[model samples]
Target chain A: MAYNLWYWPGIQGRGEFVRLSMEAGGIEYRDCAREEGAHALIENMATFDRPPYAPPYLELDGHAIAQVANILLFLGDRDHLAPSNMNDRYWLHQVELTIADMVAEVHNVHHPVGSGAYYEDQKEEAARAAKQFREERMPKFLRHFEAAAKSNEGDWLIDHRWCYTDCSLFQLVEGLRYMFPKRMKTLEPDLPKLIGIHDAVAELPGIKAYLDSNRRLAFNEDGIFRHYPELDAA
Target chain B: MAYNLWYWPGIQGRGEFVRLSMEAGGIEYRDCAREEGAHALIENMATFDRPPYAPPYLELDGHAIAQVANILLFLGDRDHLAPSNMNDRYWLHQVELTIADMVAEVHNVHHPVGSGAYYEDQKEEAARAAKQFREERMPKFLRHFEAAAKSNEGDWLIDHRWCYTDCSLFQLVEGLRYMFPKRMKTLEPDLPKLIGIHDAVAELPGIKAYLDSNRRLAFNEDGIFRHYPELDAA
Candidate 1:
């Protein structure tokens, strides 16, 4: 059955993680917010019996599932985007949650004061956050992900098969590159496995098609990963 | 089965969330780090075949589960700390993940520049982050959780039964009170349901015993929620 995905229209944000997974799994779903405008998304959230704290919720068979990692867990199981083994599924989820943590950290680099404040307002704090993120946090997170990838026999995080976590890793690497080109360029040499996953996910026919199509939103200042040249480092 | 939990000693931090659930559920577990030391916690992490990105990891049977929400999902299901229904489990998990998000934000209030940087070094930035957290983020999160508690029939988050999410909510409120007593005093009236859950969870036989025992650590500056007078507003 087809599902409805709700998120802000103009920015990729966390919604892009869900979008990439659905696209890669060839799951049938409607990008409801993108089609109906972000106001519809806000209005739709009010109608949910179980409201999400934020956007990027997925409505499946009349139930709304929120939280990017939770939604991915549901879709991953239903669409075979996760491993069949139960333990492996938990392991995969553990990795996804860590990725989620890193993503949150990435967002905080640009909005260290709070999301309520504009980036321009917190530019000085953002610069400090960015330096710490680039110098210490990014490499630490990348190494953890690379180790996870290395744990399995193949390039994927689990059982040598591409999964929802792989799609998310692809998006994460892409976002990092967009947000900190100079930093990413410096770190890429050390993240061969992560970069490999990114390259492989890019070549997937569905993801390639989505990326080339107008449906894929460009990364901008409004999104979780914003590129301010001043925040970048080498 | 007895499980071993590895986390930093001398701080409640995120590990308290897991400890509360297990204690409330009467699940058998060892606080390995507290029994040993922080160095032991780090050393134990190295032994894991699939290492956790950070602490508060539970080692069960032969496998280790990391990520507080992931570990709670595992324990909550096995020990009836979550609803029996599948969809309700997802809803509970969604709330827990949101709680996790708020916890991260709580930590960031003091450590906005990076976890690597000291609060003293970032105190100026922390003041700004704390203002936004106390004024904007805390209320938004508390309201969402209060709404979740209200969505159910009782003081708990689901099916009129106490779950791991309830324990987490109790801890969240406790941490907030410690971090921002004046702010919580002002917001408490609007969070009747949330406060009710906190009071109810606090009164649980298991939780009360744990709180009275030496096993329960006091909230401190070292933990995720830090009390800084400069950060609090009424």
Candidate 2:
């Protein structure tokens, strides 16, 4: 049975994290929102009595799970992307949660005042936020990921195998590069392990196929990671 | 064995959410950072082979779990604070994750430009962010929680009995009130279910005792939710 994944059809956004993992795990899933349209996502969300606060919910076996980290946790165990040991699973989740935190910050950099206002209305605040994000926050978060990777003697964030965290890190790097090209270029040399993991994830058979196909959406201004050259720096 | 919870010493902050659950569930745990000092939190984080990106990590049996949502998920089953069914547990987690999202956004309101910079340095940006937060986000998040409560037949966010999500909703309401008193008072009438849950959690015997005791830290400027008169409005 295929899982039904619902998210905004136009942009990768948070949903791409789930898509990356499912693609890597070779899990059969339908990108319902993309196929049906944004109306479908809104209608699908309203159908649930306890509807999700936002999109990127996964429906399988008559149950819908929202929140990227929660959905990954539910799928990790089933798809064998997570460890058998409870401790290892929680630790992996910590890394994923931190990744989510960084992703939120990335979104905030482009919309510093709040998501309610247009980017143009908040450009002045976003510039200040963008400078701080490109200078301090980006490095701090990347260093945390680097330290997590170095903790184990393997290329993966946890255990000696690729898991959901690895897929997320891969998307994060790709998105950051697209969003902050100069900064990522300058920082990539220092993040060898992260770069290596990103390369390894790209080489995965299922992920490679997805990347080559139209299934993988290209980075755009509408997505979480937007490319505003003025918002990025070395 | 008592669990050791490491977090910032002076403020309730994110750790309070974990503290509230432990208090409500009558679980035994030590506030290690509070018992020691800020130095201990720094030292303890450094000692971990795979150190967490930030604090509020629960250490037991030599296993450390970080990230508020991950820690709650780890403890939920063992302490009987989570639903027994897998689907319900995931749903509860989704609510908790959404609560975490609101909490993070709350923090960003005060430190809109950067957490590294002093609030005074970014007060202009923060004022802008806080305006959007008060006018938009607070209602949006509160409505989400209120809707979740209404969807279920029980008073709690998910199950009939109090779960970790209920504990978190309690904290979210308390923090928002402390940080945005005027805004909350204006919004509370529309949020009957959320206010009801907050009052109910406060009346829980364990929570009531903890609230009366010195164990519960008072809200201050150092925490996620800060009271800034200039940043708040009705």
Please give the lDDT score at residue B122 for candidate 1.
Answer: 90
Cα lDDT tens digits for candidate 2, B97-166 = 9999999999999999887899999998999899999988988888888898898777777656888888
- Residue B18, model 2: lDDT of 95
Among the numbered candidates, top DockQ falls to: 1
Write down the C-alpha DockQ for each prediction.
0.84, 0.81
- Write down the lDDT of every candidate, Cα atoms only: 0.90, 0.89
Which ranges in model 2 have alpha carbons more than 4 Å from their true place? Answer: none
In candidate 2, the residue pairs with backbone N, CA or C atoms under 3 Å apart (3 or more residues apart, or in different chains) clash, namely none
Scored by lDDT, the top model is: 1
**Which CAPRI category fits model 1?**
high
Q: After superposition, how far is residue B196 of candidate 2 from its true place, in Å?
A: 1.6
**Residues B184-216, candidate 1, lDDT per residue (tens digit)?**
999999999899999999999999999999999
Q: Which digits, one per residue and each the tens of the lDDT, describe model 2 over residues A4-95?
A: 99999989999999999999998999999889999988888888877789989997665679999999998998888788788788888899
Name the lDDT of candidate 2. Answer: 0.89
